[model samples]
Target: MISRTLETTLNALALYAIAAVLGVAFFDQLVNGELPCPLCLLQRAGFLLLAIGPVLAVARGPRAAWYGVTILAGLAGAGFATRQILLHIAPGDAGYGAPFLGLHFYTWAFVVFVVAIAASALMLILRQPDGEATDEVQAGAASGDALGRIGILLVILMAAANVLSTTLECGFATCPDDPVTYQLLTPSGS
Candidate 1:
């Protein structure tokens, strides 16, 4: 029974939530000096792509197309996280990167990806009214202007943060495949 405006707002909030989670991870990396591995970077890419869904939903109202974008991005992120998890399946293995609260970043990334998929699916379901198509699809996006603005702002901030962190981590070039330390800080670019 949710209205399109409400649904759009919810999607915006969900996107912001995902951005916040990634922000926390970035902070953790900065604090602990933990350079992200290849899989971790891939997961970050997935998250960034998934975040676009909310902005689109807000800009155009609730549409299955936007949710589809989220779902696909989530699946890609989940795959990356799962691959990283499998790398350390053996007992007594030190695992990649630093662990947050005893769980690695990739593990958290997996959880976030699964949540994204679920949220996108739910939004898609709620977008339909009484199990039929409705005019909400063509409704004015201006109704969700406030939420849309916030979503767009969050996207900008997230992009800037990622750019800063990535630059600091890898400098003006590509990051190493399995970086154990920040490339910019390492002597002779080891």
Candidate 2:
């Protein structure tokens, strides 16, 4: 069922997003030469997972590995988003936690997290297994749910990486020591 062109499209988007994050990391670590703070590293990890999640889903099918990755990626996104909110919303605390408070990166990541979880959940719930009906949702769904799943995952991963980095490396929303940089070159260590 996933072998169709539509599935290929989703896989492409997921792969592209994953590759972009890797590219950014390469630039930061290799080309630009930067180090990742704790939070930044976490975010980069989340993006890697995000990129891998949907393709895995596509490969194994919704009820199989896809569901597992969907849940995992969603949870990771939620955790990252929640952490940023807590740090940014800390009442009197003004330190490394609130790094992205003024910047919209925190806000954007939170939104993406929620959206990704929602989309993954919706896609999983709405999608029928290979043995069942696949045409029902496509004919009924008009929101591009089928087409947008990968895109949504990509967005979530991108935000998770950047915002997570911001929360970790920056102090009071400012860059800090050993700050991580990002690039878009390739796979090998640069």
Candidate 2 stretches greater than 4 Å from native = 1-5, 21-35, 58-65, 91-106, 133-190
- For model 1, the superposed segments whose C-alpha errors exceed 4 Å read 129-144, 172-174, 178-181, 185-190
Give the top-scoring candidate (lDDT). Answer: 1
Identify the leading candidate in terms of TM-score.
Answer: 1
TM-score, structure 1 vs. true: 0.84
lDDT of model 1 at residue 96? 88
Residue lDDT tens for model 2, 1-190: 3323344355456556555645556464554445554554565566556656665544343343554675687578668756755765767755342233374343445565566567666655555555465543442232244544555555556656566445544535445434544222223375
Q: Considering only N, C-alpha and C atoms within 3 Å, which residue pairs clash in candidate 2?
A: 23-183, 23-184, 24-182, 24-183, 27-183, 28-181, 28-182, 40-165, 57-66, 99-173
What's the TM-score of every candidate structure? 0.84, 0.51
Worst lDDT window (10 residues) for model 1?
130-139
